[model samples]
Target: MSQKRNIFEEVGEQKASTPTPQGGMIDQGRGGARRGIRAWLMVLFAMVVVMVVVGGLTRLTDSGLSITEWRPVTGAIPPLSEADWQAEFDKYKQIDQWAIDNQWMELADFKEIYWWEWGHRQIGRVIGLVWALGFFGFLLARQIPTGWTGRLLFIGGLGGLQGAVGWWMVASGVTSGEGVTTVASYRLATHLGLAFLILGYIAWFIMLLSRPERDLMQARRQKEAKLWGLSTGLLHLAGVQILLGALVAGIDAGRSFTDWPLMMGQFFPPEAFSISPLWKNFFENPGLVQFIHRMVGYLLFAFAIVVFLRGRKSAHGATRAAFAAAFIALSAQVVLGIYTVVTAAPWNVAIVHQVFAILVFTLILRARFLSGYPIVTSIRGA
Candidate 1:
């Protein structure tokens, strides 16, 4: 039998046993290999960025329609022999681009363009392989964080859809009767818009995974509601501008004017709606499309400035810095956009503009994210 201590006895005479310490549920399991998963995502992110640049190059080279078919699996193996190369070139000749534009291209020229398209598709395939491996590896290992299974699956689903849409975009140009040399502008816009959407989702997930769950939870309590709203609006506007930029790229609209602050030396482009139907002009008319893109870009920059000013007022030093970075990117992008226009969208300048657009987009997202989950600073601003 155990002896009980008298209430009046000296408390220090008896040693007390303490219970083992345990972390709260929020901190339990440490959110399932966040660093490992983030590393995987970073790999995927770099691949996607490469894919975008290669895609822009393919379009600029007019090589997108060179393949003429979407053999997702079989296409991975490019032509291995002279006969196979001829067969591929023969297939390309059936398209309007070959008939109307690239008839001057011999077998060697065909191979040159062929490689650009092939490399673009190969990059895409590699990206898919990487995503599948990382995602399923994490899955079978059961290392996926809570509430993340669906998010990962969503990205995979979008990848599959993007592949299908890519074929759809190519098919639009594969036809012979309509004299369609390039893919449909709207379809190109749709394909590119989906790409950006997927990129945006990946970026957001990376940001979320960067911090621990408990820290994120605690930071969420200090979310700046107004700043979040403004940034959200800015993000949407940026999306629209990106789509418009895609439309501009789709039809070589950027090369049409080659002027700044004016289109053909006028505030408005003449023959803006020259197409037979009113709606076709919006998609097919280079002047009008470029004008719309320019107008939206101006509006987006103005809105970004407004958001930046508000972001400067944030109490958190990190949040303010994030916004400043975004604003600076915006300013650079605007200058790049102007240069892209004045230079008539040369392949080099245009590709830089496109890649820089991604940078601007990512910086804005970073600012927006910090606004929602700000990093806390010490009194001395550590």
Candidate 2:
């Protein structure tokens, strides 16, 4: 009261000392090396993509059965001497693939297929090592963001399970008396399906890590729930189509009917259900499997159209653009599917189609992510 002054004095003239309130945990530790974790995930994503392509080529070349055993650790060391090569070839000869299909394969010819399977396995080992080193390294350094440990560990666990499932797929063909020249079609589908699942997880995590947790939390508040739901449905539909495509590849079904708009000049192939027990035809019959795959492809494209239309209504420009890109990818994928079929599923064309499928998948995932956590932009759309 004794220090009263003029009432019209400027407000800035007073300076009261007050403590600045520190933010919560996220602002304290720089969010635990998010950029570093994201960089590591990007590397893993590329490796998984390569692994899928190589695995496809391995299947396309009929080289998956070259290695009869799954010596996860020991198998990393390929044959160094001629004797070791012969030993591997000897194992290959015991399988029905040798007795029924490749009866004329010489030791030299055997080595060709051996290298494909070996390379595929070697890539897997490298992926595991990279994941282990990056994960444990960050873990020891305490650089992993909160709530990410379980997510990282889940990917590693899936990688391990994929290895086991891969062996299960190969074991189906390593028989002496079943006249089985290829792995079981369902098992092949399972293996390919798991690969895509791992890819999806890696991609999701990378996107999450690209931004700070605070931003993600804030963006999530404005999520387009309906669009996200639609995209989620589209994702599930695409997953089924992927599995069906795997079945088609597993039995070489795409090569059986090399026509467009119709299979063998008709709406359906003549011997669609020739396989016995009726149920076996869906998985074992080439004609039926390809027909199913084609039908599903059409359905997926139609659904994609619906999702695309819905995405166009989004308020966020970035979200709309993401969906547009995804739609274009899906369209290209459909064309690629037709081309692959018309060309009899040659390895070269088939691999392109497979890789494009991955592209479409990733784009769709991006669109879905944007729907959930849209990027805020200025009025000028910057």
Candidate 3:
């Protein structure tokens, strides 16, 4: 048998024989999905974002609790005939919310809620189909590199979790003594929270994958820590603000106490502490919930301002740009929120306000990576 050469030495010889590109010894290993699950995650995740924004519209229109049933398989095809429409309405009529919560709702009126609820479910069905198709395509195309099966599994698993959660949220109002119960605010928060968590991670995966496998040794330790800190903080604060906003929604606080300089004509309403011995109002009371959301919003704005100023002198262009964007977007969000409140939470204005929260959440993450990581990467390269 011919002698087998050492594999490491063989690799060295092959490396020496292969032509190096013009830039002294071009890096051979690039283009890794080391960016993680991003390339495949984008399309599916983008649709999820659409689902969320539209879901917000659905909530504002009071469409979420309308479906009144959890028909996963058969319900996929909506009312195809007039008789079918009436049948759907009959099922809806049995709910307490129909008769008591919304008195005098017409049979024709039933069709209105039917469509919004229909659209939401239809989109979910599409998302489920797309996910299945994407999974099959990956198996056929063989684009999923080794060791990444787990990640994709997580993504798909979470997508399934979302479907179940959607039902769980809607079901909360199903048995209400009143008409189709209004969606619970906490459940609403949980659903939105999971959607953003997935969205943000996919975006980050895309951002990271688009980058080269950098020489991160210098930053290999301390730098990632700093970046992680700033990034996680930004994410945490944004999430908290969103939760407060949900609390406001749950209490239907936006519709109550509609003045800016004063809620019910006082610096702080007597109702702020009207709930209990002391602390219960911070979470349970509508007036206090929205008011605290407003105050926390101001704090978030100020936090962004301070972070951006610190980023400007840090010398990383991406970090600076991302921070700048976050600050600007935060400012716009604050303004939008103020407008939504003062204007009594118009559907258009409130939806826009929520949309801007996603945009700002994105930029905050972008800046988090920009923070000391770039400089650390440069040092490692040297």
Give TM per candidate: 0.95, 0.94, 0.84
Stretches of candidate 3 off by over 4 Å are: 1-39, 176-180, 214-228, 273-284, 372-382
TM-score of 3: 0.84
Which residue pairs in candidate 3 have backbone atoms (N, alpha carbon, C) closer than 3 angstroms, thus clashing? 96-178, 96-179, 97-178, 97-179, 97-180, 98-179
Q: Can you tell me which runs of candidate 1 are displaced by over 4 Å?
A: 1-19
Model 3, 80-180: lDDT tens digits are 89898888777766766676666677767777877888888888788878877766666566655454556666767777888789899888777645434
* lDDT ranking of the models: 2, 1, 3
Q: After superposition on all CA atoms, how large is the RMSD of candidate 3?
A: 5.9
Model 2, clash count? 0
* Candidates arranged by TM-score, highest first: 1, 2, 3
Q: Residue 350: error of model 3 in Å?
A: 0.6
Best by lDDT: 2
Q: What's the alpha carbon RMSD for model 2?
A: 2.8
